[model samples]
Target: MGNSPRPGLWALEKSTDYGKSFKPWMYFSDSTHIKDISIGGRCMCNGHADTCDPADPNADSNILYDAGVDEKHQSLDIYGRYEGGGVCQNCQHNTEGINCNKCQPTFYRPSGKRWDEIDVCQQESGRCECRKEFNPPNCDSCAYGYFDYPNCKPCTCNLNGTEGQHCTPTDGICPCKYNYAGQSCEICEDGYYSAQCKNCNCDTSGTEPSICDDVTGQCICKLLHGGTRAGACVRALRVRPRRLDRRQLLGRRQVQLPHQLWRQAVQPPNFDSVKCDRCREQFYNYPACEECNCDPRGVVASFAGCGSVPAGELCQCKDRVQGRICNDCKPLFWNMQEYNPYGCEECRCHLAGTLGGLGACDTRSGQCECKSHVGARTCDQCRDGFYRLQGDNVFGCTRDCDKQSGQCRCHSRVEGRRCDRPIRAHYVPTLHQYQFELEDGVTQSGPVRYRNNEDTFPGYSWKGYVLFSMLQNEVINVVQIPKSSLYRLVLKYMNPLPDNVRATVIITPESVVDIQQK
Candidate 1:
């Protein structure tokens, strides 16, 4: 309508009966501008096409008068901005649409492809294009065991040391196995060793703490220290006795007394009073002087700077110290100190709970060699969930127990925390007696005989008593208490040698409340 070449007339709809009836009114006309227009058909294709067929269903059956139209005027001719619609014939660049602007089947427009480009729609190749270690097709995900897409690489993981084959996607670090660690599970965690990755039980003081040979699990001991646990100074440093050459001993202080001086000499010219000008606390023995350097902390205070022998033989050391300089601790002791009279504290490790059932402990820290499940500085007690520390038991305690209750599994006939004794039976379901035969439980130290005398008439179920000579005087019995409660002890003995015989009764390892009778 804006491009019409001739002027036209137009009118507005007028109604007087409330829009019930209408007629054309208010006529207007324009000569320079198009006031009104009408057309038979028009082309609506975009710039991708230059012609439209009026017979096509997508285009309008309208005809227009323009200076650029052909003489026949059967079809519209325009590059873009066509008003009529029609399917663009022989679409360009494999494109197909009402305006010839979209890609056809089996083809796709590459990202950022311009619509005006001749080859904007590329044909599908039926193949995936992906970077290395990335999944095919869309390439939006990483391949198995690979991560960090667009720059993907194989997962660096140690199959034996990692918990799983894959690693964390973002960082590419695998979850480490027990006692194993690293970004790629390449090394063992601290205080662990070997391909198996076991804990490094290095001595606390004798060896460097929390470190050992990675492959062999051997402890690296401190200076002058070595043992099963590297807990002691294996060799003692002893002072060599000083010896004098015959000529030096004879001529150095020898003097053939002159006849006049010999008559006045009383006690060998008082050799003790002789003193050398160069002699000091550190150097002694005059002509053959040597350094008297002794450890002040481990040696006697008065002998810290001097010794009687040229080689410091008389450097008196404090207790548990035995060296020329008194610098090293004695075996089974550790941590030398000035104020300590014994020079070092003893390694008082519990034999039962310590590693290998040894009393050796760390020299610097004095920490005992503890078993896997033992604790405390002395390693005397079992950790929670265990009990009954026996030296022969490698793990330091019995692990089969109720951790919360400290109760052991029992047999059908036994009932106790330790399952040590037979259960008491109730004959009438109302009364019961908890008793044990002495002959069956008591451990005797000598040849003891068990006999029964029914004529004594103690009870119908009385078993027997043990008899032994006076040489065998001690007996042992082990009992496990069922619960925490007060208990009474009773003892019986026979006095065959009746000279107003007196007997003493004793119980071992007194508990919270202790009592004895004689």
Candidate 2:
């Protein structure tokens, strides 16, 4: 019998003649007086189940235990007399309680859903519903472990060596760690050693060959030198090695003997050497070993270590100077003796007119390199036939231009300093003629023919040049005046007639004037 109460209507019947006829003897109703009997006399299945069955004694009672919950339910059976069962089946609305009264584990009944409806429960679709370390909406991909599709076999990765907790799903390979290598980032890379993977830091000069022990990170020091980092060679003196400071061990290959050792090694019995206070000429101040002073304008500031007085080592000089003192100018510079602030003046040869176009020139005379055809003192101007002096051109100019003014000759319709554009025709917007031409109002009468010659005529001449022959030929032109104003007219002509022959000109309408030409 099940531990929980059973839910069913109960009635007693007496049978006679061995399963033939039966008579009703007792019926337990809602008002019946029974001890510990619950009201309603039915299973508590909410609205999902319509009926309930009695407990089967041979059945596994563990199936009735929902997640280990065994709370008693209200029913019509007597308490503690017999275990009542409310085992419900044929659940609806996606509910899956033992009594068919609750939503399935993977689904939920949304707010405002009716109990009997088939869609009362819905599956959770949000990615946040997945496991904490799982990936994707369905949680099918594994992170920080090997993949098995919706499941994972966890494998640890080195936090210091790997960029993230995630590993390659196929091979479970973690990324390389800082200064570490291998599939799982388990060991240090070359030149580094130990669990912490520190650099060897071997001394480059004091050690025979700068390499350290792979495990201990210890360097091999040369003779007269010692220490993990390979200390400098020490000089023989009365003072013990322990007196030398750690700072005295590092730096350049050669250093002056320590002051303690100098005094012990060279001081006389009278101790007069103790009075010596001045630094040697090679240094500005001794003991501290300060470098010699150099002219800032002449030498590179970063390399100002000038050697001894009579020229021992040449200090690095600025762009256009030389000599140990950096006082002299280079071959390409001039006027160094004047003590110019910038050392010397660079000969700025014009690149266009320079022989090799490289700005090479004479240093002493300040003469710039010049091409054979470039004769100017500065080599900036082009010769007689060339124009448009430019740096990119081979001869510093394009040829074929007017020799006197260096102006290029262009076609009649083209106009520009370089003859690269077309001349636009002029238009009078207020004029009555729809399309006006140069010969618009001119009338050529009797043996006169029209001709056009743009090259032979001046640019402002109308319709180019026109010719007329014979004495009876005549040309008449009409003019329109937009406003009253003083005007001048000039006519140019070429006639084959004798020099003594006379020609008559006439102007009429609105103050006409006539003149005779011979």
Candidate 3:
């Protein structure tokens, strides 16, 4: 307070309740300044309500008086300036204590300062450049995916192909999507599958070109589908390609007409060669050249040239090869050319009898040249004492019969000078000199022997009693036939006596030897 209209006085604490209520905080005088009222003291002045007066709170503090002013005597001469509470002098409205060392509201002390600097607080950016999370206002704590100090750095999640605005808080790592590999999800590896990157299924043995389609992973079909659809000659139908034709226009060099040249289906793009491939009429397209349908042995020759070669002018065959297609044999097989299926049978030439082992039979006559005694178209016959069982040219003769002499030739199974002896035991009369034993130790002493039932052998057994009817000396002269000649034995059995004996005689095959019994 500086001026006043009346003479009055100001008071200090003058607490109404000992020291509780600090009210009536006005000057006791008139015309007081808020600054002086804020400072409590015994300040007094003189003047009417309309005249001059020290109306400030400081008018109560007499210790704060001017030396030339006095309130009660209305004099200019005042005294008593020495006092204890002078620090609040000229204190601003915002200040509190005896000293004006503090600032007003909305202001604070700046942290970290020297003692010389006033401790008064000041207005700031509402932040000390902190809080990366907040935007323009006060800098509070940082947001989720951001780290703050002075700079608001976005969380870069290690570039591992992660998505979204916020990366993992702990490590800044991110998750990747499907089928995408590498750090940035930038690459699709392998091949395209289901619209996604996948591995290829390439055949190890039959992979063609590069084995796989670099994009879709569907097997790549290079070439004009000429090879297998999958590059292998499997049984499935192949994927056909658009064929290029002459009329399609390319100056005409090659062709792939269906059956024209079945042998060379893949024609040369240039037709300047001296020769052009052509298949026979019977030939069909099977990737490679196939042989004619006619019999190879009968088809003497063939011509091929897009059917330009007349059928009538086909390769001519000899008369021997007779047929519409020259696929037949002519003349008798024995005398004709060596042909297959329509040719002659092999000549049955006996080793010793046929043309002195030359085996050169008469082809014209189909006659086999035989030895002296052997008589047959094949020269494989034998005499009475010998026989030819069956014939096989691989062996020396027909079975065991000698071809030249028409005689029995011993096989390994039998033994004898003439192969007439059965080494095991003769069960038949087939041998010249072999016996069938009816029983062992067979005599007239047993009833079984007398009844002809000693034991029936494989063949008939002989057991008989002999008797001589002549009572006088009958010395019969008999001739013994030699082994060199053929012979037979004749026997006669009759009455049985103790002294008299019956004899059976052996004679030549002509019955020349005589016999006498007594």
Q: Which predicted model would earn the best lDDT? A: 1
Q: In terms of lDDT, which candidate is stronger, 1 or 2?
A: 1
Candidate 2 error regions (>4 Å): 1-319, 323-328, 375-378, 400-518
Error of 2 at 441 (Å): 38
Candidate 2 vs candidate 3: the TM-score winner is: 2
TM-score of 2: 0.19
Model 3: how far residue 474 lies from native, Å: 21
Q: Summarize candidate 1's per-residue lDDT along 87-162 as a digit string, tens digits.
A: 4454566886655667889887765677667778887643344555776434778766776766677788875787
Tens-digit lDDT string for candidate 3 (1-518): 56855456766555778888776555565555554333223321211111123245445542333333332332221143423233233433333322333545665545453322434334432323334454422354445555443454666533333455344544545455554444534444333222244545544344444444443344543343322222221122233435534442111112334224223122322222224354434443332333344445544334333123334333334444544444444322234343434333445566565433644444455556565446667666653343442333322234445557655666666766577767785433434453323233222333223234324322234653212234321223224335453335433233334776544433324444643222
Off by over 4 Å in 1: 1-293, 301-304, 307-314, 400-518
Between candidates 2 and 3, name the one with more favorable lDDT: 2
Candidate 3's C-alpha runs over 4 A off are 1-296, 299-320, 323-326, 329-507, 511-518
TM-score order, best first, reads 1, 2, 3
- C-alpha local distance difference test of each model: 0.61, 0.54, 0.40
